[model samples]
Target: MKFLVLCLIALIHQSASQSPQASCQFENSIDYTCVLTLTNPNGLNNITEIEVNHMPNRTNDDVVIVRTSIFSTSRNIPSIICDTFRNLRSIDMFRTGLTKIDEDSVSNCKLLELMTVRFNQIADIHPNAFAENAELRTVQLDANNLTSVPENLFENNKKLVEINLSQNGLAVLPKKLLSGLSELRGLFLTHNQISEIYEDTFADATNITSLGLGNNSLTYLPDKIFSSLYNLLDVYLQNNQLMKFNPYWFQNAKSLRALYLSNNGITYFPEDSFVNFYKLRELMLDRNPIQKLPGKIFASLGELTWLDLENCQLVYLDPSLFLSTYNLWMLKLANNDIYELPGGVFGSLKYLATLDMTNNQLQAISSTSFYFHPDLRTVRFGQNQINAVDEKFLDVVNVTQLNMEQNVCADGFWNDDSETKELFRTELRVCFENYIEPPQYCPIGNEYERICELEAQTASLTLENAGIRRDLEGLAARIEQLERLISSSP
Candidate 1:
């Protein structure tokens, strides 16, 4: 009888020792609530049976926030874990190898307000997965393999302020997916396969401020898709296949500030494309195939401060292209076919600070290329065929940083410093000794001709004044000689 009892006790001890274990530690106190962090370092497939050690002064009920990390093979969040933390307010699980979110996985945590299950292999989430978490305010499920989500997925979470579904395989958003998320402030759907958005998709998201839809396969957008988002501010649509830009997309989003449309197939823009975006501050149109821009295209964007047009295949720029964007602070025109900068092309950008014209075919940096902008600080002209730099180039624009590398000028001429003026003079006498001004493609308008005439008249007047001074000096010498002769005779 004693030997049988001993065998039974040994069997029980061995079975308990082999069970997977998850350790819990007390984190810093947040809002006077004890926060507990549970970690499974043994690649445990089951964490529900693990015992949790509460803080010295707190019990399981006293914990409000629970974070789980480093779980290598947990397929789903066990309901028993959330059931134990009935008063939980937040749960964060990252890179846990979770493949799916089962319905009511966290339904026991009634007070849950924030949930983050990012960087996991989660491909599907049950439509009612978060149905019971009515108070949920933020949900971040980015970097997952989710291709689609149900339309009513977030219907119960009315107070949701932000949702980040970026870096996923989502191809399309259901028409009513965000139907009642009136309190939504930010929605990030970048790096997905989204191709189309219904016109009423954002009709109820009137209060949304920032929308990110970059790096997608969207080739077209409905004209009135964003007609209801009046408070929209920043929009990111870069790296998409958008063939054209529609002004009606932002017809009602007057509060827009930043607009990004780089790496698209857009070839041109109508003159009134940005007429409704009066308050827009930043505009990025780089990496397009646009060969030319219409004059007065930016006439209404007086408040625009940043403009990017890099790699647009622009062979020429209209002289009055930027006639109204006076507040522009940065302009990027790099990696194009521009052979010359039309005179007064940047005359209206009085606040222009940084100008990038690198990797172009510009043959010369003329004196009138850059108009006087007091804040001009950086100018890049590298990788061009520039053999002639006007002696007055630096005098017109006082750029503190100038990049002229890989040009025809001597190495010493690329130096940009207080002595740059003297270096430029020396380079002109040596490298550009036989330089001839390139023929202007744009006609020298009446204003330019009138200025040239004025300059010629001034030069002729200066020569006449010098000759008069020499004659006056000779007459004074003769008069003094005569006076000395008269005095000697007396």
Candidate 2:
């Protein structure tokens, strides 16, 4: 009798652990894969919420998820549903008129990994909305009306990696707002009204790799705000009202790859400002009022590739400005007041491929100015005072396009050698005539070895002319002395 009781106990335990197979219908839609779904039951009760008792046993239950479309019209997600969908992985909702999430709504969703409630009118959330949902990894609440979030809302969720709360009315981030998410890799808060961020807002989020604060009203960021994020990769601070860049802002973020600070009122960048970003690659500072960049500002960013300083109202650039940016590929300096490019300005950018200096006040460029860049392919010097071109400018053997149109030159400057002009594919139109004396329109050497030989000849002639002028001045002084002596003697 004792043995028979043991067998009966074993059978009951197996039955409790295994759930019955749930019936499902295939939706056959392109965007969604068919999964275990719950349809509204027909009856007077109407089943306002799903309870733990309504689900099958844990062992037999398949992964359950609430489709985004169905949740769009759903009113709420009760705390009881967490018990029913114990094996659930995701819960998506949108446009459901969800105004608030009460406490413990999804506290015990042990297997929950992803949740999205975007494009809704949700304005509030209980502190325990996801209190103990440890397995939750991604939460996307973009396009909501949320003004504030619980400071400890994600305190119990250590596995949370990404949180996107963009397009909201958040004006400020409270300190410790994202305190417990230690594994977070991405935090996007773009297109908001955020004017300030607390110093300790990201105190515990050390693993964040990408942070977006663009399209906001931020005028300044507190010092050491991102001092702990060592693995940070990308930062977007565009479309803000920042007046300056603090040198200590990215002191600890050395693994940064891309930085965007475009469309701001930044007038200057401190020297050695990017000394900590050793592995940075892409930097965009376009559309700022920066008149100049400090020398050695990009000294430590040796791994940089793309740099955009377009429309920054720059009047001049240091000759060694790009001395450390040897690996730079694409550089855009279009729409500035750069009157001239000194020799060897781009000597350090050996890998530079595309250079855009269009719409500037460049009057002349030396023949050996681009000598270091052997891999250069395209160059744009249009709409300037450039009246002459040398064969050395086309030294890059693989150069495909050279835009020199709309400048001071004769219309038939390159017409004498139509073959080489066709081979180079340059826009050598005569937009203006040279007004200077002697009209230095000569380009030394042929297309193969375009050296400025006339420059040397001009230098020799200038020295001879200077000697004659000195002799004439000396002779005039002696004649004046003789005239004075003659008058005094009389």
Candidate 3:
């Protein structure tokens, strides 16, 4: 029989020359992606996949990449590209341990777009797995250990845009959990242990725009909970134990722009809290124990520019408070318990630059305190109890780094007085003339030389008492001219 047809052509050329394995390549045989890099026992333990049904440049819309080399060991995520690449588009299983993912595990890949089980340990995921994937857009179950998420898991991925369950342990988020992901745009539940977040929780992810609930344990947030995210932009509630923050849940976040409530135990804040954030520009209420605030609370953020009230133990500040932050530039009231700053507080900040009242209890600062519009720069009154510095304080703007460290100067004041040390040396460079204490020393060894020896003996006793009154007026004018010439001596 022709030697059994040459022994079946030598067994199909030894199964197409031992099926691609020199660190398999051909990354794209014209959209038919292929990249099987397995090497550690060559194709690790005699290959667990890549049947490629007699590969001779496989095609059926081929897309296969079974990478495994980093001293490979944790394998089992290969359903052989869902049973030999039936037009599969993507499947990247990196650092595998994919503990669970049933429902035919990506059966009929249906042109899968991208499914990355990143740095895995993936804990169960069978709600029809990907419910027969409808061209999934992107799903990277980041650093997984996922707790629960089977409510129609991704409800038939509506062209799902992005989903990275960041460092998961997710506690609760199962109400229509991202219902029909309406084109979700970046939703990463940062380091979750999520504590309450319902109001139909993002009701179908209304075009979420960057929401990473930072280190979650969130305390409360359910009123209109982001009012359907109206194209929301930037929301990362840092750390978290959120105490209160319901400004009617952003009254329809008018395109919110950068808002990260740092740390958190947030002590209330609803004086029209950012009135629809009118395109807010960087606002992070630092730390938070927020002591008080209601003077038209930021007067409607008119495009506020970077304002992080550091520490927030704010004492007083309502002189038309921040007068609509007129383009404020970098203002962080560092570690506050602020004592006083009321008169037109920062008088409409007209482009004010870097003013961090470092560690406060400020005693005085009013020469129309920071008035008029003039791009002033860097003024951090370090650790304050400021004992007087109003020699026309900041004389109408133009400062260049003045930190007034740990103040309390008053005798011969601020540098042995050269007219109050040239009034803070023409707007500052006084570079730390130390003193948080030591100043009441009055043993007068030299009080400016005893005040210049009492003003030079009172000006030499006023010229010796005017020469004894001009010698008694010249002896009464020669005794009245000898008594009028001896009474006319006739």
Candidate 4:
């Protein structure tokens, strides 16, 4: 019988290539979109509608956006398996070790608009999960393990614009939980464990424009909680334990722009907090314990541009503290106890560019220290007690990365060569040729006491020219011993 019909057609092509939908790895797209990747689904739980009717040349109504990545599946997500993709609009369930998400999972993907259960271990979600996916606009349950979420979840997704519960473990947020997200604009509850936030919790999410409560464990914040966020723009309350900084919490968020209060416990900032933030532009109060700042506190933040007061234990600053931020360009007063920088304190920052006074208690760098930066570029006076450096301090700023490491000269006297600015101005005239007088709270002026009296009269004419070159080498060795005793007495 022709060897038993070729051994039954090689045992039916090795049992149809060991099927379990052949370990799913489909790709169909040509508008009928379907990207099913089930890697490591070794204990394959279920995806059978006979595996979407054996998806080979696409069939279940010719699929419609099903993007799935079920890696290392633990369980629960097979609930009717998206009711066989009822012409699903979009469903991306990545890293599926999914834990809870009831309500028939995708409620039969009722023309779902976009749902990405990202990095799952999903804590619990069935508050009518998506209540029949009312054209859900976008919902990426961010890096899940969500602590709480279901104040009517998305209350029937009123075309929800974006909702990413950032790195979840959320502490508390259900204040009507965006009750009717009027096309919500971008709400990312960053690294949650949120201490408190229910002042109407975004009131109705008034057209939110990027709000990411950073790190979170917030100290206090219900002063009108953002007043009603009138078209707010970028507000990430960094780290958080905010001690004080409530200018009525943005008295109506005047279209705010970038305010990340870095690792807070903020020591101060009441002076009109930011007087309506005049279109604020990137202000990050770095690691706060702020010693002093209220010099009209950024006056009204005249369109500020990136200011980060690093490690604030600042000793003093008010030289008009950035006088209206003259369109600042990256300023970071590093590790402060700032000894003194007062003279025109950065003189209205003429478009300053990257100034980080590293490890302060600065002794001297005066020549009006960066004399009004002409587009200054990278100046980090490392570990200060800088033994005076103004031989016109690199002739008035044009710094191209000058990090005077562990100051007081002698360590190759600092370098980053703008051709070492005339070799650090001839090594600051021989490392301070006995240069002293700097104290009177050193903001250094009296023209630095006339350049330390012309570097002490040029170190006393360089010790009278090394004592006339050692008396002309001892009279040229007594004229070579009187010409060898006059040629040995003739």
Best by lDDT: 1
Instruction: Estimate the overall C-alpha local distance difference test score of candidate 3.
Output: 0.67
Model 4 per-residue lDDT tens digits across residues 290-374: 8888777787887888989889898988656676677788899899888977555675566777888888988776644333354
Residue-level error in angstroms, candidate 2, position 437: 14
> What is candidate 3's lDDT per residue for 43-161, written digit by digit as tens?
22233455334257566455543344343333344454466566666777676555666777775787787888788777888788887888888888888888777867888889988
Q: Candidate 2 vs candidate 3: which has greater TM-score?
A: 2
Comparing 1 with 3 on lDDT, the higher-scoring candidate is 1
TM-scores of the models, in the order given: 0.83, 0.74, 0.31, 0.33
Sort order, TM-score high to low: 1, 2, 4, 3
* Top-scoring candidate (TM-score): 1
Worst 10 residues of 1 by lDDT: 460-469
Residue lDDT tens for model 2, 1-490: 9999999999999765342222223233332222333332210112344422223333224535645344223345545445555676777766655556767667767788888788877788888888777898999889988888887878788899999999988898767768777899999999999999977788889999999999999999999898888888999999999999997888888889999999999998988689888899999999999999875788787899999999999998875577688789999999999987754467557678889998899876554455334466677787877775544344322355567667675222122223244544344322212222233332222221112232323322222222232232222343443344344442
Better of 1 and 2 by TM-score: 1
RMSDs, each prediction?
9.8, 14.9, 22.4, 19.1
Question: Candidate 2: misplaced stretches above 4 Å?
Answer: 1-60, 70-72, 78-84, 94-98, 404-490
lDDT of 2: 0.69
Per-candidate clashes, comma-separated: 0, 2, 0, 1
**lDDT ranking, best first:** 1, 4, 2, 3
